[model samples]
Target: MEATGRLPAVRGIDAAAPFRWLGWAWRDLWTTPGPLLLYGLLISATSLALSWAIYRTNAAFWVLALTFGFVFVAPMLAMGPYEAGRRLDRGELPRVLDLLLVRKALRQDVAYLGLALLVIYFFWGRIAQIVYGLSTWQIYRTIPEFLTFALTTAEGQRMLLVGSGIGGIIAYGTFVLVAVSAPMLLDPRASVFAAVATSVRAVSRNPGPMLLWALVILALVMLSAATAFVALIVVFPWLGLASWRAYRELVAEAPEPAAARPLNPVATR
Candidate 1:
């Protein structure tokens, strides 16, 4: 679709809007489980593979880098769910291959926006490490030992507060950049700048509901991580579909083209 001359109006939704979107997302998932489940499984397997690959190196940085960096990649990960929701809206069944069909988006602005996010995520991980370094002098050799130190020490508590604060800032920034921009990128005609601006405006206009939505996402992601990413098999897809609905609601409809600039009055006369 081509970009309309004017940007659409972003709707102001209530706090309950996020829940409603989730309900719609859940319905989309069950309505077309086969493909979404397969996509989810693939993501789960990839995450496991990454964990396994990094664990062998015994490097905490690599592990943490990928773990936290997963957030940066999630918008891309959920592209399939976004498409599924679109299909459902059109009363069409979503296909499994649609998950891999992002090649079209990749050729356009999505890939560039994704790269920008990657840079931000890399810096976020670096900031997290700096926080850890400043807060602790202990050098633990193992995951369990490190966990114990963090849980049982004053330095660890301070580190948690500092790190979490910094992390939250980075996460919020990324959310504002990608929330609606990503879906807009799926449209071939939309430029990255325009998409990002639309997203910022949407969040600005609907701060309450958007913040609520972000909190909901954070809660679900934490739950999934706590379960060792297993819960993502469901939660991940659900969030994806819901995000698509969010974009649809937030971006305004395109304006009608100017009626062939009415023939010059004098010429018509």
Candidate 2:
């Protein structure tokens, strides 16, 4: 989606948007880490439970993969900043328990997220096929005087490189879209498409900071893996709050009134 307009000009490139985002993120952590932690635990538990159930069933690879995709959508409603925003606006503290109670909104969000995931998966599948075809061609070319040897070597390397590239593209797209869409979805005023579009445009316009953000996310994911995924309890909430704050910063808004009461912060369902 196209950016609404060029990013607003500020005084110094050195004082960039991401640094400002970092500051907002820090403030959220300090003021509301308890709520964030609760949200994270809810997300992590449901996700792990779904994944373990699928794994234990010895499901087909594609079946397991699709189930995993569905699992991600389920938690989006719970972990999404948009849900928090809605709750905050209503003067309710965001809580994991809200997910159990907010059935209608949760269902609506799940449907929206599921549709997005399907579209993403369709494109991703095509990209995977392309890489597999390339790999097969490479293996065929690598077949030595002995057809078996050269073919196998060439195919393996081709598949490896092409698969990696496809994965990278998918990862980058997911990051850009997921970054802002959740919060947008939570806002009663915003449409899902608008949120996704805005997110994509935000990253496109601010490539440098977005890259740094992506790196930070990746590092967190790596650290989580090292901790047997336990680190996500902290990392997920931190990033979720960070994303909400980042969305507010990147998107334009009117200045707050000097004497107005602070906006109520809510958790997304």
In the range 4-75, model 2's lDDT, one tens digit per residue, is: 533332111122555555555555554555766766676667656765564456532323234323322322
**Displacement of the residue 218 alpha carbon in candidate 2, Å:** 2.9
Clashes of each: 1, 18
Candidate 1 stretches greater than 4 Å from native: 1-5, 60-65, 254-269
Per-residue lDDT tens digits for candidate 1, residues 1-269, read: 33565665677777887887888788778988999988887787788778777676675545654676677778877888877766666566778887768554766577788789879878987887788778776556556766776678888878777877878888888999898988777676778887888899999998888989988998987787677788888888889988987887667652222234321111111
Rate residue 191 of model 1 by lDDT. 80
Q: Where does candidate 2 stray beyond 4 Å?
A: 1-16, 19-23, 54-82, 85-92, 99-110, 122-160, 254-269
User: What RMSD, rounded to one decimal, does every model reach?
Assistant: 8.0, 7.9
Point to the candidate with the largest TM-score: 1
Model 2 lDDT-worst window of ten: 6-15
How accurate locally, in lDDT, is each candidate?
0.75, 0.53
Q: What local lDDT score does residue 267 receive in model 2, on the 0 to 100 scale?
A: 21
